[model samples]
Each structure stands twice: as C-alpha cells, then as structure tokens.
Target: MTLAVTGGAGFIGSNFILYMREKYPDLRIISIDCLTYASNRFVIDKLSCDANFRFSKTDICDRNEIYRLFEEEKPDILVNFAAESHVDRSIDGSEQFLRTNVLGTGVLLDACLRYGIKRFHQISTDEVYGDLPLEGDDPPFTESSPLNPGNPYSASKAAADLLVLSYSRTHGLPITVSRSVNNYGPLQHGEKFIPTVINSVLRGKNIPVYGNGKNVRGWLYVRDHCAAVDLILKNGREGEIYNVGATDYLQNIELAELICDRMRASRDLITFVSDRPGHDRRYDIDCTRLKTDTGWSPETAFSAGIEKTIEYYK
Candidate 1:
C-alpha cells in the first residue's frame, strides 16, 4: 500500500514513519514536510536508502504543490501530521497556526477528495476538548466530548476537525481522526515539556515550572502512539474518531520531580514561573473505544518510557 504522510520530519510523525518502515518493508511511503522550526532533519536521513520511502519538501497549505505531488504519487492513504502544534508559539502569533492548521487542512481535504483517496487520517490533539478540572468528579473526555478548545492552537485544530467531519458527511470522503494526549519521547522538539527539562538538566540550567506546576497531563510515549495509529489505519472505520492515550497522569511538578530524580539533579533546580494564558489545568482522555475495537493498548509504562527518553537526551 502506498501512504502519504505529511510532517513526517516532525516528532510523532518521524516516529510513525520509522515504525512503519521497520514493520512494513514493502509499503511505499511518501513523507512531505515544510521544514518548520519543529522539523527534525536528522530523522529523514536514515530513510535515504529505502527504495520504498520518498521525501518531499512541500507544504500542505500550498495547493499546487500538494496537488502536484498527489498527481505524481497517487497514494492510497494520506495521513496529515503537518500543523503548527506548539501552544506557546500559537499564543504568541496565531496567524501561522490558522494558516497551517485550518486552511492547510482545507487544501489537503480538497486534494484527497479530487484524488479519490481511500482514507484520509488526521492526527489530532486532545486539547481540542479543552481542560478538565484539576479536582473534579467528571469522567475523562471520550470521543463524544464536546469540542471546547481554549487556545488558538487548539481552536485551529478544532476547526480542522469540524471541516474533516463536514467533508465526511457532505462529500462522502473516507476519513478517520485520532486525538491523542501529550506525547513524550525522542526527537520531540527541544521546546516541549519533557525535552525542555532534559535539555535544562543537561546544561545545568534551572528548569522553569509554570505557576504551581500542578496541572496534570496524560502522557503517551511516541512509539505507542505510532502503534495505535497503525492499528487505526488498518482497522478503524471511516468517519470515526479514536482517542489514544496512556493512563499515566502526572502533575507538572510531579513530572519535573521525576525527571530531576532520574537525572540525579536537585529539585531546587525547578523555578516557578508565571503561568501561560489559558493553560489547561488537566488533560485526560478515555481510549476505551480504541482499545475495545482495535485491541490496542499502550505497551510502555511511564517510568520505562521516561528512562528511555532520558537516555536518549543524554
């Protein structure tokens, strides 16, 4: 099967590409990326010799460029991972986020419709559901949860998701959406929480903690996410949404402490800073649908995953 994956040079996308390359050698894969600040150039270097893999430096927002590549490649499946994903960056300037996440998604959807692709999978974030109370009796968000995005980044994602669903209903486009929780592993950009802490510890710099650092986040290892997506690609029904996440919910302070403890650094190195605007107090999602339907579950424990990530950064 021929698959086209946008933003394959980014963290989760790169991990997915690597996982697929190793698991399915005969799968013809086309990875297109615009080389944004978050893109990892080194990840695609390893695929240089694989006859089945092709890398294209193209943006999903560029209709002509995406259409040209689609015409040439004629891929059966398109997995869109290309997006301006950083919340902090989006808060600073929202134009790029809207352009890439909303408009770019429209461009891709148009191409997928015109090309008559079998499936168009959109990789998404659980933040589109906004936050749950830090101290609450409310159940974790499920696939049926309402879209109540808080930040520009999430708003853009939510907009794209609505567009995807509209196309599925109105145009009969085959589509699947996977909304995942916080991803932590190797090749994640240095700006993310885990990598930022790792980099700070290595450089002997104080790790900045936002507010009281008690915001909870459900962490999913990147490889596990990749496997889940693979399962969804193979078995997920079209016009459906799947939530992918691990049960390891840790507060920001607790996560920071664990990293410091693992690296033999002092907890005093963590400095409390002002919280970012619209920071979600907690992020937890229910993956029961994915687990029951696809027989998929997270394989890596948080402790083991964090250890691997620490070793990678070291």
Candidate 2:
C-alpha cells in the first residue's frame, strides 16, 4: 500500500514516518514537507536510498501542486500532519495559522475529492476542547465534547476539524480524525516544553516557567501515538473522531522538576515568567473510544519515556 504523509519532516510526523517504515518494510511511503524552520530534513535523508521511500517538497496550501502530486502518486491513504502549531507564533500573527491549518486543510480535502482515496486521516489536537480546570474533578474530554478553542492556534485546528467532518457528511468522503494530547519524544522542535527544558539545562541557562508552570498536560510518547494512528487507519470506523491520550499526566512544574532531578541539574534554574495570553490551564482527553475500538494503549511508562527522551537529547 502507498501512504502520503504531510509534514513528514517535522517532529511527530518524522517519528511516524520512521515508525511506519520499520513496521511495514514493503509499504511505499511518500513524505511531503516544505522544509519549514522547525523541520529537520536530515531525518528523511537517511532513507534516501530506500526504494520504498520518496520525499516531496510540497505545501498543502498549494492546491495545484497537491492535485498534481495526488494524480501522480495515487496514494491509497493520506495523513495530514502539516500545520503552524506554535501557540506563541499564532498569537503574534494568526493569518499564517489560518492559512495553513484551515485553508490548507480545505485544499487537501478538495484534492481528496478530486482524486479518490481509501482513507484520509486528519490529525487534530485536544486543545480544541479548550482548557479544563486545574483543580476540578471534571472528566476528561470525550469525543462528543463541544469544541471551545482558547487560542488562535487551536481555533484554526477546530475549524479544520469541522471542515473535515463537513466533507464526510456532504460528500461521503472516507475520513477519520484523531484528537491527541501533547506528544514528546525524539526529534521534537526545541521550542516545545520538554525540549526547551533539556536544552536549557544543557546550556546552563534558566528554564522559563510560564505562570508558575502549573498548567497540566496529558503526555504520550511519539512512537505510541504513531502506533495508535496505525491502528486507526486499519481498524477505525469511517467518519469517526477518536481521542488519543495516555494515562501519563502531570503539571508543567512537576515535569520540569523531574527533568532537573534526572539530569542532576538545579531546580533553581526554573524561573517563573509572564504567561501568554489565553493560556489553557490544563489539557485532558478520554481515549476510551480509541482504546476500545483499536485495542491500542500506550506502552511507555512516563518515567521510562522521559529517560529515553533525555538520552536522545544528550
């Protein structure tokens, strides 16, 4: 089978490509990326000699190029991971986020409709449900939860999700959506939380903590997330939205402290700073649907995953 993965040079996208390549040695994988600042082309370069692997420098927003590529590749499945995903960048200027996240999604959906595909998976995020109370006993967000995006970044994603659902309903397009929590593992951009902490410790610099760093986030290892996406592609029902999350979760401060302890760095390096506008207090999602439907669950323990992550950075 042939699979086209957008943003395959970025963090989770690169990990997913590598995981799929190893898991299905015979699978033909086409990775598409425009080589953005956060993208690492070196990850894909290692596979340059593999006959089953191909890379294309393409932008999802370029409708003509996307259509041309789809016609040539005729991929059986398409997984879109392309987006401007930084919250701070989105707040500074939302136009790019809207263009890439929402409009780019629409372009891809149109391309799918133009050229038939067996499955089109839209990778979404739990931030679409907005923030949960940090101290409440409120249940994690389910698939049916109303979308209440708190930031421009998440708002764009929510719009894209709605567009994907609309295409499925109006055009009978085969589609699946996975709203996953924060993922951490190898090849993550340095701007992300864990990577920032690791880089700061390595450079003997202060680690900036936003608003006391108490914001909570559910964490999943990138490889485990890739496994879940694989299962979703194979066994997930059509036109369904699955929430992907793991049992591992903690406050930002706790995570930072643990990293410092593991690295034998001083916790005093953490410094509280002014928080960003509309920062979500917490992110929680229920993965019952994903687990029940795909028989998938995270295998990486929190501590073990952190150890692996630290080793990778080191």
The C-alpha lDDT values of all candidates are: 0.93, 0.93
> What tens-digit string does per-residue lDDT give for candidate 1 at 260-294?
99999998899999999999999889999999888
Give the alpha carbon lDDT tens digit for every residue of 1-314 in model 2.
89999999999999999999999999999998888898997657889999999999999899999999999999999999999989999999999999989999999899999999999999999999999988979998999999999999999999999999999999999999999999999999999999999999999999998997899999999999999999999999999999999658899999899999999999999999999888999988889999899999899988899999999998
For every model shown, the clashing-pair count is 0, 0
lDDT of 2: 0.93
RMSD of each: 0.7, 0.7
Candidate 1: pairs in clash? none
TM-score (C-alpha) between model 1 and the true structure: 0.99
RMSD of 2: 0.7
For model 2, the run of ten residues with the poorest summed lDDT: 37-46
Superposed model 2: Cα runs more than 4 Å off: none
